[model samples]
Each structure stands twice: as structure tokens, then as C-alpha cells.
Target: MHILFLHSNYPAQFGEIAANLVAQHGDRCTFVNERVSGDQQGVKCVTYRPASGATKQTHFCAATFENQIWRSHAAAESVAQLFRSNGALAHDRPDLIVAHSGFVSALFLKEVLPEVPVVGYFEYFYHRYNSDFDFRSDLPPQSELSAMRLQARNAMLLLDLHHCEAGYCPTDFQREQIPAEYQPKLQTIFDGINTDFWKRDASLSESHATQRMVAGVTIQPYEKVVTYVSRGFESMRGSDQFLKVADQVCKKRSDVRVIVVGEDRIAYGGDARFTDGKTFRQWVIDNNDLDLSRIHFVGRVSREELIRVFSVSDAHLYWTVPFVLSWSMLNAMSCSCPVIASNTAPVQEMVRNGQNGLLVDFFDIERWVECVLQTLESPPETQRMGSNARQTIEQNYCLTSCLDKMRSLYQNVRMR
Candidate 1:
């Protein structure tokens, strides 16, 4: 079977699955993307550039919608140019097309190839009230204009839902955001982690006998190491809360050190301006009573380094609004790191409070600090939770199991 994968930024959610299919099926699989950071072996990469973004002529509310329209047209035209001549298939057309739903790349694919089925990756559906917009208290006040824009953002996704053969989301909580009428068509299948690469390293503790320096800070194996990671230090990921909790932990325990991994910028929930003329990171540091000496902000590191960090961490902190789940949290769990996560929808699905990991209310700073300190104080309990965390990933969210389920889903879609 000829399978075609699509994502504006190539090799994202589809990277592992596409690469696996190419290795197993050889030249039978191809990937169509807008751009790729690195090349993938055993797969054909086709690049397509969408038209420029919105301009002054575009209506304010419709600007977001118009950008998607451009993407839809550009992707459709690019795919056609590659495989068509005189409005006919000039090369072997795809038997099945799997695409990310946010970009509208597959919006026109059905119009181009009426027979081939398209399976969409449904990551998130926006809502004004019980969603990311309202999940956090630190965010700026919402307005009617912002609400309208948020509503318009879903124009493309709604279109894809109606046109695509089937759809899948990474978590059940994310799948719930979609309209009830469309829920039957969407299934939950996490973009799994590579267990072999992320598994706990038995030699990590023994190899580093003396004090070790990570991100320019010295940390002895005997010291309590609490770690937090996100793509950016933003409100959506609960960076603010993490900093506060770190302050509390530092005051109680002098041996504890907090390692933060992420850039100091806003990636989600829009820009939040501080009265002190400091970035969110700086604002947190200045306002909180944290010991600057114990906090280490390490910008983005490589995947290998990330796994190693997770392996050595005493407790991993992960918090986010009720949105798409972070893959880093799963990787931390796969590395047998005890996780203290927010009691949100996406996290609750994976972390059973007091089971694999402890969950605290997102805004409950005292409880968050207590959980982290408890995990640090009790080595035996922490070890048990860490073991259970790894088991959770191995059984459900590992690459091997997720890929098998993906292949079966694709076959079912194709058969229909």
C-alpha cells in the first residue's frame, strides 16, 4: 500500500510512524511536508511552501481563517504538481493520506483524489470557556475579539472533520474537546515514546560518584534534584506555579536543587506583560522568595541529554492547561522519574494520583511543594512510584505498542 503523511512541520507526530512504515514497507511510503529540520532515511520527503501570512487587507476576525485557506490551497497545488499532469495522476498516487488537522493540508486532498482516504491527527479543539483560554488564572482578561478569533481558528478543523475518513487524538482528554457529533469519528492514540532510548540507566548513579555539573550548576548525587521541562516558560505550561513551588521547596530543604529546561519566552496563552519590565522567568525569580543559587535554568538540550537528566531526577514537574499533553512528561516517566503533575484532564488520564505519580491542583502552590518534598524525602516510595511510572509507559505509551495500533487503524480505514 502507498501511504502519504502530511504535517506543515514535517516529522512531528507523524515522524515515528512514517519512518517505521518506510523501514518496513520500503518505497511504498512517502511524506509530504512544508519543511523538515532533518532528513529521514527510507522515506521520500516532499516539501511544499504555503502562501504568505495575513496582511492589512485581511479582516481581523477572518485573518486566521484566511491563512488556513492559503495553506490548504498551497498544499493541494503542491501535491498535485508532484503527481499530476493535465489534471491526471502523472505518478503513482497515494493509496492513503494521513495528515495533521490544524493546517488544512488535507482539506483539498479529497477534492484532488476522490478515492484515497485521509486520516487526520486531531490534536486540540479550541473553546472559549472550559479550555486553554480559561484554564489559567494568570492570563490576561479575555475579550470579545479574542473569543471571536478563537472560534474562527476552528474553521479549518471543522472542515477536515467533515471531509476526512477518520481522525485520532493523542489523549482522551483532547478528544473530548471536539464536538459531540464528531466524537464518534475520533479515537485516542498517543504519539508514543521510544522506550529503549528513554528507559532508566542503571549505570547513571554509579557513573557519577562525585559532584556533577549540569547547565553550569554543581549537583551531587546525594542532593535532591527536582526537574521541570517545557518548550517555553509560559503561563500555559504552569511555569509560574513551578517557580513558586521551587521557592517553597528551597526554603524547607537546603539540599534540594531545581533544574528547569526550556527557553525564556512565551509559547502559549499569548504575551503576558509584567509591571517590573522583566520576562516571565525574570518576573518569577524577582517576585518569589526563591534561592537563586539553587535554581538552574538550562535552555533546550538534546534528546539524549534530556533522557539522562530524567534518569537522575528525583521528581519531575509537569503542569499544563487542559490542552494537548506534552511528550516530555511521558519521556520522563519512561526513564523511571517520579512525576508530580497538575490534576488536569490530559494528565489525569496518564497519572493516577498516588499511583504512578502524584497530581496536585494546578493553582495549589502549597500542595505542589508538599508533593515534591514528600517525593524527595522518602526514597523508597519515590523508587516505587518511579518504577510504576516506567511500567505505565511500557505497557500503554511505548513506541512499539502505539505503532501497532496505528497500523491496525490505518488498515481499518483503508478497508472501509
Candidate 2:
């Protein structure tokens, strides 16, 4: 089979699945993106750049939609070139096209390959209230323009939803965010975790007395490690709340050390505007009286080092607003790390409170500290939750199972 994958970024959500198809199924794959870097074996890369984007004169509400249209136009032209005499279509064309719906890259693909079945990977649907936009009450109240922009942001997504033959969301929580009329067109399928690589290392148990090193940080035999991973230090992931909880926990328990992973920049928007010329990390540190020595901010480490961090973790802390779920939480759980995550819709879908892992209200710093302490003070119960966490991933979110489901989706769509 031949598959053409489309995204603004190269080898993103489709990377592992594309590689799997090439290695195991002997399928040929081609990826189209605006910025193409990195190499994936048995897969071809094509680049596209927009001729122009929204200008300063453009209305704020329509600026995002305008940029998306330009992206769609650019992506369409790139794909059209692939079908020319000097391109891959000189002999054969793709059997199917799978695209990330975030940027609407596949919006105009039908103009290039009208007969091909296009599958959209819908990540999230924006809402003015009861979603990420309005979830943070601590931040300043959103203006009417913010609500208008939020509605306009979905223009391209709605078009792509109607254009594609089929679509999928990583979780049911994400799928439910879309318009009710289009709900039937989408299915839930996670971009699975590699449980084999993330499985527990029995040697790193808290009962061991040996000192260990992870990502250049030394872990003493008597110390307890609490792990937190995020793409950025932003309010979307509750980085500030995590720090507050960590500070109180460290104050109460001298043996506890917090290992934070990720960069200092805000990956998601809206938090930076309120930070008064300082990065969100610096702003949080400036306002709060946090114990800097006890918390180690080890900026972004490799997967191997991350696994080591999780393996030694007494409790993995994950907190987020009601938004798209972070893969790090699942990865930590896959490593058999006892997790204490936000009791939000997305986290609740994966974690059964007190069964697989503990859950606390997102705003309750005391509850978060209590949960973290519970994991540290009671080793046997924590170990049981860790074991169940790994079981949850293996049964529902293993890479093999998800790949099979993806393949089934492809075949079914092709038959339409």
C-alpha cells in the first residue's frame, strides 16, 4: 500500500505509524509539511511554504482563518507537484492520504487527488466556554474579541471535517468537543504508547539503597523523587499549580526531591500575555516563595533518560486544564510509575481514582500535596497502583493494538 501523510510539521502524530507500515507491512509512505527536517527510513519527505500570510491590517478574529487558508493553498500546490511528470505519480499515485486537521493542510487536497480517500486526524475543537479558553479563572477575564476569535478558529476545521471521508480523535474527550452534527464522522484512536520500552525497571525500586544518576542529576538512597513532565511551563498544563504543590510537599517532607522536565517557554498561548515581560517560569518563581534547591528543573531530556526518571519516581505529578491529554502522563504510567494527576475530564478517562492512580482537584494545592505524600509514605499501595497503571496502557493503548486499529480504519475507508 502507498500512503501520503500531511502535516505542518514532519513526522508528528503519523511518524510512528508511518514507520511501522514501512517496516512491517512493506508500505510506501510520503510526507508533506511546511518545514521538513529529519529522516525516517523508507519514507519520503516533501516541503511546502505559503506565499503570504495574514497582514497587520487583517481583523484579529479572521487572522487565524486567513493564515490557515494560505497554508491549505500552499499544501495543495505541493501535492499537485507530486502528481506531475517528474514526480512520484509518474508511475503510481497514493492509495490513501492521512492528514492532521489542526492546520487544515488537507483542505484543498481533493482538488489535487479527488479520487483518493482522505482521513483526518482531528486533535481538538475550540470552545469559547467550558474548555481551555475559559477554564482558567485565575487569568484575566476574556474579552468579546477572544470569544469571536475562538469561533472563527474553527472555520477551516469545519471545512476539512466535511471534506474528509473519515476522521479520528486521540480520545473520546477530544472527539466530544467537536460539533454534535459531525460527531458520527469521527472515531477515537490513540497514537499508542510503546509499552515494551516504557515498562518498569525493577532495580530502581525505592527499597533499594544504591545511589543512582539520571539526566545528570544524582539521586540519593534516602531521597524520594517526584516527576513532572510537560512540553512547556504554561498555565494550560498547570505548571504554576505543580510548583505550589511541590513547594509545600518539599517543606513538609525533607526527603522529597522534585524533578521537572521540559523547557521554560509557553507551548500554548494566553499565559504569556499576563506575565509582564517575563517568561511564565520566571514570573511564577518571582511571585511565589518556592524552594529552588529542592526542585530540579532538568530541561528536556531524551526518551532513555526520561524512562530512568520515571522508574525512580516515587510519584509522577500530572496536572492540566480540561484540554487535550498530554502523552507524558501515559508514558509515565506505561513505565509503571505511580501517578497523581488532575481530576479533569481527559485524565479521568484514563485513570481510575484510587485504583490505577490517585486524582485530585486541579485547584486544590493541599489535595495535590496530600496525594503526593500518600504515594511517598505508602510504598505497597503505590506499587499496586503503578502495576495497574501499566496494565491500563497495555490493554487499551499499546502500540500494536493502536496500529491494528489504524490499519483497519484505512482499509474500511478505502472500501468506501
lDDT winner: 2
lDDT of each: 0.83, 0.88
> Candidate 2 — which residues are off by over 4 angstroms?
37-39, 87-91, 203-207
Scored by lDDT, model 2 comes in at 0.88
lDDT of 1 by residue, 158-263 (tens): 9888988898999998898999999999888989888988887766644557786665567885788899999988778999888888878988998888888888
Encode model 2's per-residue lDDT on 389-410: one tens digit a residue.
Answer: 9999999999999999998998
TM-scores, all models, native as reference? 0.94, 0.96
- Model 1, residue 406: what's the lDDT? 84
